[model samples]
Target: DQQVKQNSPSLSVQEGRISILNCDYTNSMFDYFLWYKKYPAEGPTFLISISSIKDKNEDGRFTVFLNKSAKHLSLHIVPSQPGDSAVYFCAASARSGSYQLTFGKGTKLSVIP
Candidate 1:
């Protein structure tokens, strides 16, 4: 089975600092990678994504990087904020037409002021 793994279960960062979240996947066939952020008692919201063809994709403070050779990817949040504290999940899909995400366990980030 294709699996996404997050080595760190949680991370702590002071406000205005950078937060780096790591993830690795086992399947080379997977072409799409995504990150989702979820708050307590709420559904997850899409954070960012990157295609296998591209090494990096960025939107404002959120950036997703893909290393197809290593089957590894990471998300970087610059100047992390307290509101950024949430559970982050890394997901991947081989299907391009319809996305069925195979998600990592999740990494909870606590951004402290």
Candidate 2:
């Protein structure tokens, strides 16, 4: 079973437009959530995170919202730029002393110039 799922394999948006990415999880035990942006042939870098205690988290142009009731989460990028084009991964962990993260396959975002 996929503990985390990113239904959309890819998304395209014009520069300076909002880009929204969705994600879902099956494990209700998961408590900590994170979003990572990655480029080809490189490791993912942490973008933002939200704890189960909160419903939303934001960082500059990036924002993440978590809905525990639906076991769902989403990432929003405001005024997306060509540089924003890359793979975004949603990850989660159960917060039980295990730092191991469960990641979605990934969603590739392409910003057209």
Candidate 3:
């Protein structure tokens, strides 16, 4: 069974608008959540992350929020731009300090100009 799941296969947002991607996890041991953005023919790059202890984390135009009790998390991008279009993967790891991660299927985000 997939521990992490991205229900929406894709999303479309208008430029200068907000883009929100959602992820859900079934593994309760997961204590950290990360978002990765991947462009075509390139490796996934780390975007933003949040710990189970905190409800939210932000950097520049990206923000990640975690709801520990709900086993849900979301990434929000404000003023979405064309460059922001990519496949976003949601990943999780336990507190065991292992580098290994469980990843969701990913949500492809398209920002329309």
Worst 10 residues of 1 by lDDT: 93-102
lDDT of each: 0.93, 0.96, 0.95
| lDDT (10s digit) by residue, model 1, range 63-98 | 888888899999999989999999999999986556
Lowest-lDDT window of 10 residues in candidate 3? Answer: 93-102
In model 3, the clashing pairs are none
Cα shift from native, residue 19, model 2 (Å): 0.4
Q: Give the TM-score of candidate 3.
A: 0.97
Model 2, span 11-94: residue lDDT tens: 999999999999999998899999999999999999999999999998999999999999999999998999999999999999
What is the alpha-carbon lDDT for the whole of candidate 3? 0.95
Sort the predicted structures by lDDT, highest score first: 2, 3, 1
TM-score of each: 0.94, 0.97, 0.97
Candidate 2's C-alpha runs over 4 A off are none
Summed over model 3, clashes come to 0
Error of 2 at 85 (Å): 0.3
